[model samples]
Target chain A: MVLAAESQLRLDANWIDYLLVAFYFAFVLGIGIMARRSVSSSIDFFLSGRSLPAWVTGLAFISANLGAVEITGMSANGADYGYPTFHYFWVGAVPAMLFLGIVMMPFYYGSKVRSVPEFMNRRFGPTAHLVNAISFAVAQLLIAGINLYLLASIVEILLGWPLWVSLIVAAAVVLTYTALGGLSAAIYNEVLQFFIIVAALLPLTLVGLHKVGGWDGFTDKVAQGPGGEEQLSSWPGTALAGFDSELLSVIGIVFGLGFVLSFGYWTTNFVEVQRAMASSSMSAAQRSPIIGAFPKMFVPFIVIVPGMIAAISVQEIVEFKETGQGSVEYNQSILYLMRDLLPNGMLGLAIAGLLASFMAGMAANISAFNTVFSYDLWQTYVVKEREDDYYTGVGRVATVAATVIAIGTATFAASYSNVMDYLQTLFGFFNAPLFATFILGMFWKRMTPTAGWTGLVAGTAAAVTVWVLSEDVTGTIAIGGQGGAFVAAGAAFVVDVLVSVLVTVVTAPKPESELRGLVWSLTPRKDFHDPDEQELAWYQKPTILAGIALVMVVGLNVLFA
Target chain B: MAERKHEAGAFDIRVFIGSLLGIYGVILLLTGLFGTSDADLAKSDGLNVNLWTGIALLVSAALFVVWSRLRPVVVPDDPDEG
Candidate 1:
């Protein structure tokens, strides 16, 4: 009764907290105003005119992906499953991020394509490009809706406002910044948000760890908690995988999560890739994701560790962990900690940090969507031969349109939250197939355009089929848990490679001459290297940084495991 | 060969980060020093969290602002003006 009485839906934020949040909003809008002076062309509007330095693009690169889902969802995963939740970072993200920086970025940056889908247009012609563009646009809208929905929910909880008011205000803030300054506004705000997020999370983790008697005491308590000692270790990750067989779980992790899903999403998702593309130079672009990998690897200490501590310290999380019978959602792990631990000033900073993250995420999606819509969809198909200024205007218009549609989708999400699970599985079918098609088309110059589109279609179909046939997150025909999505991704990749090979054999190949910069083997050495690369210090080079990141990640795995 | 493209007079991201962090840092530092009560310290497991975190934020904010001041970005000559 005492615990239940204390467990209210609202956080204890005072006027100072409100003041802090208002200051953050003013700065966010101010950044948009500052960014507006730079938007002279479509490229400026859509890609920051490719003028941002590596550190800016790099931090923005990771921040774009660290939405509400990351802070809340990862913490939720930690509360529910324990250390195995970290596998999402180590196995599911880091390596692929490194591979993207060291290997794939050169081709993308070298081609001088305005967007990722634009690269597809030049290589496999319009059909493949159209497929990628539409799917990417739809996916961004849906995901942005989820982010906006969560952002509104947080605002409602924080301010005690109605959901409708919160929704409009959140959407309006994102719309104003994105439509005003375009990607420049989004990227700059994202960099600021990234630091704010760290400031918000670090205090919670440090204070939580201290409360739980530091790392050693926390580990000991977790070993004795509701989930038992199995929660302490990371490998095999049977609890995280939702698989009974140890072999199946390990295989599901290494190949399914590590190889397929990781590569598919990190390498292909345009929202994250757009940040790297906005870098001032190819060297900056190549260095962007690599720079991001440094922070990406360590963020779990702040996010997931707090969740683990919450499982022991917070009554709601502890009760939910003990008996799955409470009204507590796992995502509330951070909020509960804030309510219980953070004083008024820190509380405001934490609230502002959450707002910044949600806005950063939605802004990334909106900006990426507008670029693809204005360039790949509108200019190529809807209208033609217009001035570059006209397209810049179109991008702004698209930004408004995308935010409005996302608000609609957010309402739908509010009503049918379960629909989000279904849609995520449905869209999870996208990245793996696209990755399969890209890796195949890039390395194998003999791949025809027909093969390109066909492979994409078949791979996505294969993932969908596997999801349908399986017990749908319970692992009857296929693996389940978070690992279930991994199996679906693996299935999509295998089927795509097989279909592309067969289709390429029968269809006429694109002539090698046309494959020049598009295909890896056909691309010149200059295409892969920045002309000024040698002049930079060793640490600034992508390859060296990627190597360092790889070793550090491996060392972290050993230390934690 | 493609010429190395450079633009001048654009917004510098470092200055933006530096200023924002500076503002948040100073306010949090002030709150920690003056407004923090014993109840606040008790909730935070007996540590002066606001004070410590405020100090940390101020330090980092100083670093960011100094870095930007030392290396502020400037746009090259506008070809249109040329």
Candidate 2:
């Protein structure tokens, strides 16, 4: 109830927090205003005039992926699971990026579509396109709103501000800049936020490490804990004390979670696609994923290592009889660590970085939502024309609208028992289905439009049905008994895939000719050369080297971890 | 020239397959050589060895960069096909 207690006792008088929040909003708004000139056309507004260099694209990609949930949730996950949580970054995400770069990007870029749904239409058919667009939109709403709520909680906690006040402040900052600048504004601000977060976190980790007398002393304290190795480094209760990873769990975490999750994230997540869309040409688009893959390799160090330090500190604190509400909600452990550890001006910067993370997340989502709404929904339905001004204007309007909706939702979510639980639950409801539809639509050329729609609708319905049927969570269909929502969603995906393939075979096949360009972009063509056909630029090699450096940095962490 | 065209396609498959083979080979080698000792060597209290898998990954990733750079550029006949 510390959260509730803390929620009631506000520090609105904290001028430093207010100033930091104000500065963030001012920066965002200034960018929005500055971007107005560049955004005359829809291409400029939505795609940053399709001229973002790979580094900007790469930085924006990482910023969008980090989000508010991840900044807080991964720390929470680390607190709960210790160092193994790093698997989410390394085993799952990075490899997936590599795979995408080597395999998937070529296909997507070769098609040269503006939106992912357009690619679906080009490759599969209208039904596949429409289904994915609808599912993705719904999934984004759930995720964006929930993340906004979680982030608002942190702002509320850090500044001693009220929930509505914090949510409003956060939403206004994101919306102001996003409404003016579109994708360019979002990416530009995100690049700045990425650096600010690193600036805040790196010193925090080093200081915290020093506070605990370096790694040796830290390990000694952890070893003396109640759970021994289990409490300190291993996932909270797992018996894999000395084992690198449990055989089955490693397979699940690495392949199932890593491969499937990473594939789903890179291939389907629209925020990531926003960067790809800004590429000057198809190769840039393809190479963009490769470039972006570089940062993901280092995320574990920036995120998980600090989290590992937190677990040690908290374990030490608890051993000394300081078992309080701070340690109870594992997600807040990082914040609690920061509050107790950080000194003055640095505290201001860290708080600013936290807020910046939230703003970056909200900006990306708002931008992505507006892009999809303007392109896939509004342009598809209310406005048929694809003119620059109309679409760009519509995108801006939708950005403001989504910001409002997310803010309203945040106020409601602030009262929820656990924002992460609620968001993950909602994510299970929709994301699994979107993941299913995208995978099938991309791989199964024999898939029919009818089958695609059926799979998506049925997949979502089944997941919801299972959630409802759980007499504990709700009451409805008794089918499948009580199961985790993700499990149910997974089941639904299997059924949907089976039903889709069966129906597709029974139904008429779309011509393979339609899919050739999108599906087989890697195939060589005679009498064809690319415009940007210089050897993958020299500066571009930094991304490669950065990728190498990131791996080395994390590799060093592993040697020391 | 026609025979070279066929040979190029064959070479493309080799590059793709060879890269894949190399990845598995490296993964297998790392697992075989360090898999057991990494467990004992990383047996520290707060440090987990699987975390070192990230290092092996970092090393393998170097290979990935080299592999990607070395990937046979198809060099389409038209300059704009990319």
Per-candidate interface DockQ score: 0.44, 0.02
Off by over 4 Å in 1: A1-7, A38-52, A386-397, A411-427, A473-479, B1-10, B78-82
Q: Mind listing the fnat for each candidate?
A: 0.46, 0.00
Expressed as tens digits, the lDDT of each residue in B1-82 for candidate 1 is 2333343323566666767777878888899989999999999999888788888888888887677667655443343322
Candidate 2 lDDT tens digits, A1-561:
535645532222244335445555565566666566534532233333233346666676677877766677776655555565665566556665655554566556666677777777776677767777777776676566767776777767766777778778867755655555555466666666675576567666666676677877766755664335543542222231122335644444443345544456666676786676566665566566667666666666556656656766754335322353342455565676666555333445567778778767776766667777878877786769767898887876777777778877766555544344455446555556666766676666677778867776787787677666653266463322112333454556666777777788788866776666554432354212255555766555424644564575457436534
What's the distance in Å from true for residue A71, model 2?
A: 0.7
Q: Kindly list the per-residue Cα lDDT of model 1 for residues A8-118, writing each as its tens digit.
A: 578988998988899888888887776664454423433333445677778888998898667877887888888887877888789999999887888888888768898
TM-score list, all predictions: 0.92, 0.74
Instruction: Point to the candidate with the largest TM-score.
Output: 1
Off by over 4 Å in 2: A1-5, A8-25, A37-52, A231-248, A314-328, A382-397, A411-427, A465-489, A521-534, A537-561, B1-82
Worst 10 residues of 1 chain A by lDDT: A415-424
Candidate number achieving the greatest lDDT relative to the actual structure: 1
- Give lDDT: candidate 1, residue A70: 79
